[model samples]
Target: MRILVLANFGMGLYNFRKELLKELIKNNHEVFISLPKDEYKPKLEEIGCEFIDTPVSRRGTNPITDFKLFMNYKKIIKEIKPDIVLTYTIKPNVYGGLACRVTKTPCIVNITGLGTAVENGGVLQRITLYLYRISLKKVNCVFFQNEENKKTLIKSKAIVGKNMVLPGSGVNLEHYNLMEYPKPQVVNFLFISRIMKEKGIDQYLEAASYLKQKYSNVNFHIVGFCESEYKNKLTNMQDKGVIEYHGKQSDVKRFYEISHCTVHPSYYPEGMSNVLLESAACGRPIITTNRSGCGEVVDEGVNGYKVKPENSNDLIEKMEKFLNLSYETKVKMGLSGRRKVEIQFNRRTVIDTYLAEIHNITER
Candidate 1:
């Protein structure tokens, strides 16, 4: 079958969904990927997939630009004549999906995350929901990353068609196999996510500040590019010894190797957090928010601890709680997380599920 994939960027596809794409090619299917021309495009091409440069202004909601995107998708679909279509993120799901509908092509959409606009509740949320409702009407299937997202769309009547939930682009266990838990002498915590307000960077920074002053052996590390006005603040914090900032790393396994625990304080509407999944797969204990996307990974004191959303005090308290655990217990906690990911979030499971759905769709 000829398969076409639409997405906003290449980083996520190259990182998370490469396994699925590889499997499709191994099955002798011709695959074409459509997204903005980014660094990972060549990598995707190297993996035997054709790349189509589809300009997408990811964060903006300009009507003229969106209409152009819709038209572009329509043009691509009409020319390629793909047997099936797959789309990720918002613009691809909405606009790509609409194009597929008009062309009478089968399309599958993955709701990676709802973003703050939908979850925060506002005019934008209403507009986004309306777009989803119309675009997904005739699509073959809808895959949500989490149950909360599924419930929200269903309750809002945005998804009245066939849909199901998936473990947000499940982690690759082979790539991120269990690693030895770092020694407890200097307990290091990692905060990996885009430096945005919605991602709870402020809460993480606050916790880092208080904990660093209170404890001498602990180190707080920040990773990922700053999508907000946090460059100067991160620089200041790093210079002052409050946190160690490593801006945007393509390879994070080395950082995970030195870390004892991973911290994610995000309050954002995430489909699922790849950072937590990857960290857990690497046998690292996690300290994250007590929310859906994050809460699902942790087993509440079994694998890791969860703090109240946006509460710096609670975050500090949890870090202290983790700090007080015996070294042996920390190792056991990390192992527990590894076991969870292996059983529940393995990347193979996601790939097989997609293949099964695609097979069923085509056979019908």
Candidate 2:
């Protein structure tokens, strides 16, 4: 089968869907990936997948630009005549699905997250939901990273009836296998996410400040690219010694190895958070918001803690729990996290699920 995979960014497809792509190739499927051109093009090509540049804005909604994107995707779909189309993220899932519909090609859309527009709830949110409902009508299957998103789609009538749900992009257990819970001289807490205010960076900074006042032995690390809209806020957080911002890291495993705990206080709606899964796979406990995708990963006291979204006090309390845990208990929590991923969020399970769905759709 010839498969076309569409995502917003090249790096997103390269990093998140590599296992699925490899599995398809192993099964003698020809794969073509469409994404915004990025430095990761070489890496995508190296994986034996053809890459096509599709310009897209990661943030905000513009109908004019989106229509152009839709037309561009429609042209690509007509030209490729792929046996099946699989899409991820917001724009691709919406516009790509629509384009595939025009070509009478089967589409499998993965709703990674609802994004800020939906979470914020306004005219844009309503319009996006309307578009989603229309686009999804022709999709053969819809995969969701979290139950909340799946439920939301169903409630909004965007998707209904037994939709597939997978845990994030399923972390590669072999690649992010359990590491010894590092015993650094100073305890380090790392927040790995795009520098977005909606991700609760402000709350994280506040918690870090609160923690630092009492616990001088702790260090806060922030990893990810700073978006221009949120750059000034990130800068202010850095100036306050709230976080040691390590912008856009290719080697996140290194940070995971050294960090004591992974924190993602995202108040914005998320699909399943990849960082939480990777951290858990790396045998690190997480501190994230008590919201849909973020809360689902942690089993409360078992592996990690969940705090109220955008509430620094709640985050501070959770951080204190980690700080207060006995060394043995901390190790045990990390091990529990690894076990959870092995059973529920393994990469093989995700890849197999995707392949099975794709085959089912094409066979029909």
Q: What are the per-model C-alpha RMSD values against the true structure? A: 0.8, 1.7
lDDT of 2 at 279: 94
Candidate 2 segments exceeding 4 Å error: 160-162, 228-242
**Candidate 2 backbone collisions, by pair:** 224-248
Report the C-alpha lDDT of model 1 over 1-364, residue by residue, as the tens digit: 9999999999999999999999999999999999999999989999999999999999998999999999999999999999999999999999999999999999999999988779878899899999988998889999999999899888888787789888889999989989987767899999999899988999999989998998999999988999758999999999999999999999999999999999999999888999999999999999998788888999999889999998999999999999999999999999999999999998898899899999999889
lDDT by residue for model 2 over 147-201, one digit each (tens)? Answer: 8888888999988534788878989888888999887567899999888888888
- Model 1 bad stretches (over 4 Å): none
The TM-scores of all predictions, comma-separated, are 0.99, 0.95
For residue 8, give model 2's deviation from the true position in Å.
0.7
Task: Record all residue pairs in model 1 with backbone atoms less than 3 Å apart, i.e. clashing.
Answer: none
Instruction: Indicate which candidate wins on TM-score.
Output: 1
Whole-model Cα lDDT per candidate? 0.93, 0.87
